[model samples]
Target chain A: MIAENYSLTGKQILHFETFGFLVRRNVFSAEEVAKINGEFDRRRASILAEIDPEEKRTFTQWPTRNPENPFTASLLDDPRIYVPSEQLVGEDSIPIQSHCNSYGKSSGWHVDTFDRRLCVIKNILYLQPTTADRGALRVIPGSHRSPLSEDLRNMDLYGFHDDTSPFLNASGMRGEDIPCYIFESEPGDVITFNELTWHAAFGGYKDRRSLSYNFFTNPKADDEIESMKKIVEHTPANTQGLGTVGLEYHPNWLENADNNPRRARWINWLEKWGFTDVLNN
Target chain B: MSMLTEQQITFFNTFGFIILRKVFSDEELAIMDDEFETSLKTIQGERPDNEVPKHFNWSNLGPETPFLSLLPEDPRICETAEQLFGEHVIAVSSNSNRRVGNTHWHTDQSHPHSYGLKFAAYLQPLNSDNGAFRVIPGSHKQPFNDKLKHIEMHSSEITVPYYSCDSAPGDIVIFNFATWHSSFGGSTNRRMCTIDFYKNPETPEEVEGTYDQVIVDEKVYAKLRAYGSGFHPHWLANPQNSPRRQRWIDWLRKYGFVKSEEA
Candidate 1:
C-alpha cells in the first residue's frame, strides 16, 4: 500500500525525466475515485445545461480551486497529487489549473505547449478503463527533448490541412498509425507527463471523462516567467471562453487561501509574479 | 535511385523506424522464401540428426543462394539505407533466421556513438498477438536509449510503451540499431530475414563505435561458426565488385574479422 504522504522513488523520477512521463497504478482507492467521479458528473451536468443543444457536446470545467466543490478543490492539497508534482518540479511548484473534461472527439497528436521554457507537468486521471483501441493516451517517448523536438516542430505535425500529415507522407501510415506508447489505464491510475511531450488519443467514445491537474514549476528565470504569463493570459480565452473575465482562480479559492498554508504560499507566489492580475478581476 | 521521400526520412529520424508496404512483389517474396528454405535445408542436412535448431540462423550471403545474397545490394534496400545514413553507408551483414517462442527487448547497437539499421522482412502474416515486431519509438535517441536499459532486465514486465509493426509477406520494416525492439507470441520456426547496415564512420568517435560493433559481431560470428555456418567465399571476395561492399570488406579485414585465407 502507498503511504498517506507518499513521495516518488528515485527510479520513478528517473523514468519520468527520461521517458517524459510516468504512470502510477492504483494511486487512489476506489472510494476516492468514486468521489472524484461524483464531483465530475455533478459539474459536467451543470455545464452541459448551459450549452446550446446543437453546439459541440464537449464540456470542460475548472474545478481545482472552485469553492463550490471543496472535495475536488482539496485534490491539490492531496499528497498523491502534490508530492509527485513537488518531486518532479520542485517544492515551490504550484497548482496552475485543474480541468474536468468530457471529451466529445479524439485529440490529434500535439504537445500541450511548445514553449520549452515552461516547466509544467500535467497529471491525468481517466474515470474509466481505456486501451489503445479505445481512448488510451499515446505518447512518442523523449519527443520533448532537443533535436527530436525540433525535428517534430519542423514537420508541422499540427498544421496539416487535408488528410496528408507529415506522419502519413513519410511513413505511409495514418496519424493514428504513428508509432507511440499507449498509456492503457484503469480508473485509479495516475499518469503524469511533461507539458512538452507529444501525445494524442483516438477512437474514444463521446463523453469520455478525464480530469487533468496541472502544475507549474515556479519560474526562476525571466523567460520562464514570461512564458508563464502568456499561459495564464491565454488559458481562459482558449477554454471556450469560460470562467470570470480576468480571474484564473475562483474568488472563493482566494478567500479560502488564508486558511490553507499550501494554497496561501502558491497565491503569494502568483501575486509576486503578477500573474494573478492577468484575468483582471 | 533515391527510394525514400523527404517526409519518410523525417519520419524515420523522428520515430526510429518506418514500414514500407509491398516493397517486394508476391512473386519476389515467393522466390526469396524458396531461397531461404533451401538454405535452411542445406544447414539442417549438415547437422548430425538433420534437425533444424530452434532459432536456427545462417548467413544470407552465399553464392549457393544468388537471390538472397544480393538482397543487401538491391536498390530497394541499399538506396533506402543510403537515404537514411547518406551515400557512404555500408552493408554490414545479412542473416536469415527460423525463430521460435519470443525475443526479449534489447538494442542491437547499445553504444552511445554507434549508429546502424536493420531491414526486416517476415515471411508470413503477423500481428500484435503473433510475433509482430515491436519498438519503443524515439527510444533510439539518447536519454531515452539509456533510460530503457531497465527493459533488458525486466522484459517480461515491460512497463514501457511500444508499437507493434504488424506486417505481411512483402512488407519491409526498417529500424535504427539503437531502438529497443522485441517479438512475442511467435509460433515455432517463424521465418524472417534481416540485412544490417551501418553509417560509414566520418569521425573518430564513429570509428571507435564501429570498432565496438566489430566486437559484438565477432561474438555473433563465433556462434555462427559453431552452427556450421560462416560468411561465404563469394561474399568475402566481393564477386559483384561493388565499391561500397569493398569498403566494408576492407574494414572487416582491418579488424581481423576477415582474413586472406577466408577470402
Candidate 2:
C-alpha cells in the first residue's frame, strides 16, 4: 500500500529546485531491491545469451510491459517514486522512457536535452553499490539554469572540434577532475535529476546495472504538444514491442490500469495522441 | 547609398541570409587566400595540445593579421551590416575553418532574434554535389523553426527543400546566427573563414543578451591555452579610433568576456 503521507518536505523541494537533483536514501527496502534485481538479472541473462558479448550492447525500457513479474509492475504505483514525482513535476506527469543499462564505457558529460521548453526528469535506481571508480553518477549543481547551461550547451563535449578537452573547464582539467557531486550509493538508493542537468559517469564497470524511469510534464500549450510529439516520434520501440506499433505505450501496463484513476489520466492523453489503437490490436 | 540594394535587404530579412557576389576585389581575394594558409600554420604552431582535433580554428583572426584586420571596418562590410542591424554595429569575432566531411543541419545559436550574424567566404568552389553550404530558408522564425530544428536533431535523412549555396572564391554568404544550415557532401580539406557581427545593444536587456551569447562563444576557447584571454591579445591591444568598435570592446571587457588582464 502507498505510504499515508508520502510527500517531499519543503527543504527537499528547495534542495531539488536549487541543485536540480535529489537523492532519496534507501527509498526501496532491502527486500524490494532484491526482488527488482532478481527480475532484471534474469532478463539481462536472457538478453546477453541472445547477443554477442563482444558487441557489448545495452537494453532500455526493460521489464516495462512485462507482466510475469508482479513486483516490478507494482512500481507503477510505488509511493516512494510516484509521490516524489508528483511533488516535483505535477499529478499530470507521465513516464516516457525507461532503461536497464549495462554501459560499454564511461560516458562523457552531457545534459539529457538541449531545449529549455521540455521538462523531463529521470529517476535512476542503482541495483548495486557504486563509487566514482565504479561509475557513480556525477553532477554539476545548478547547471540546468541559464548562463551555466548556455555555456555548457555550446562546447564540443563529445569532441566535434577534436579538442578532446574537458568541457566547462576554465582552466585545463581532466573531465574527471572537474568539481562535481558524486552520487555514491548503496543498493536501493534513488537519485532523481532534471534531464537538463549536466551529468557523467567515469571509469564504470562494463556490467554496471542501473534502471531509469523518465517522466515528463504533460503538454499543455500547442508548442509543448508539438515537442512531446517529436519526443515520441524519436523514441524507438521498447522491449515489449509497444511504441514500435505506434506511439502507444506498453499494452500490458495499460491493461493492468483497471481502476487506477491516476494512470487513467495519462492513458486518456495517450489515446488522444493516437496511442490507444495498439491496445485493441 | 547602401552597399546592398533594397531588394537584397528584403530577401535577407525574409530568408535569414543573402549571398553578395564578388564582395572582395581580386587583390583582396589573393591576400585572403595567402592569409588563410598562414593562419593554418600559425594555429598548428601554437597548438598546446596534440590531442586537439587537427581541423584547427581560432577566433578574432581580424587583428591577428593585417589584411584580415581591415575587413570589419571596410565600407562594403560595415555599410551592409548597418543597414540591417542599425547604426551601432559591433564586430564580434572572426575565424578560419578547415572543414571535414558533413555538418548536420543546426543553428549556431537558437535565440529567437536577429541580434547576430556571420559572413563566410569559402576558398574554393563548391556545389551541393561536392559539400556545398545548404540552408532551409525562413527557418529562423518561430514555432515552425523549432519544429524543423527538432526534425534536424531527431532524423538523419533531411527531406525538406533546402537552398544549396553553391559558391566560388569571391562569393560572401551572410546568415542570421539562428538560421539552420549544414553542408552535405564535402572533402576533408575544405577551407573557409567567417566574420561574426552583432547589433549594438540599445537597452540593458539587449546588452545582457549579447553578454549571454559571448559566454556561449567563449566556451570554444576555454579549452585552449592560446585562448587564455578569450579574445586574442591583438583584439585587445590594437588601437582603434572608431567609437563603435571601442564601445563594443569596453562592454565585453566590463562583462568579463574579455580577460581582465588583457583589458
Quick one: best lDDT, which candidate?
1
Candidate 2, after superposition: displacement of residue B85 in Å? Answer: 29
Deviating ranges (above 4 Å) for candidate 1: A1-3, A57-59, A159-172, A233-236, A239-248, B48-56, B110-114, B150-158, B224-229, B236-257
TM-score of chain A of each: 0.88, 0.85
Quality class of the docking in candidate 1, CAPRI style: medium
- Candidate 2 predicts chain B with a TM-score of 0.87
Candidate 1, residue A45: lDDT: 65
The candidate maximizing DockQ is: 1
Candidate 2 RMSD to the real structure: 16.6
State the fnat of model 1. Answer: 0.63
> What TM-score does candidate 2 get on C-alpha atoms?
0.48
lDDT of 2 by residue, B23-77 (tens): 8778888998888777667766666753335355655444546777657767877
Model 1 iRMSD vs. native: 3.1
Q: Give the lDDT of residue A254 in candidate 1.
A: 79
What is the per-residue lDDT of model 1 for residues B97-134, given as tens digits with 9 covering 90 to 100? 88888998888884677789999999999998899998
lDDT of 1: 0.79
Task: Give Cα distance to truth, residue A165, candidate 1, Å.
Answer: 4.9
* TM-score of chain B for predicted candidate 1: 0.92
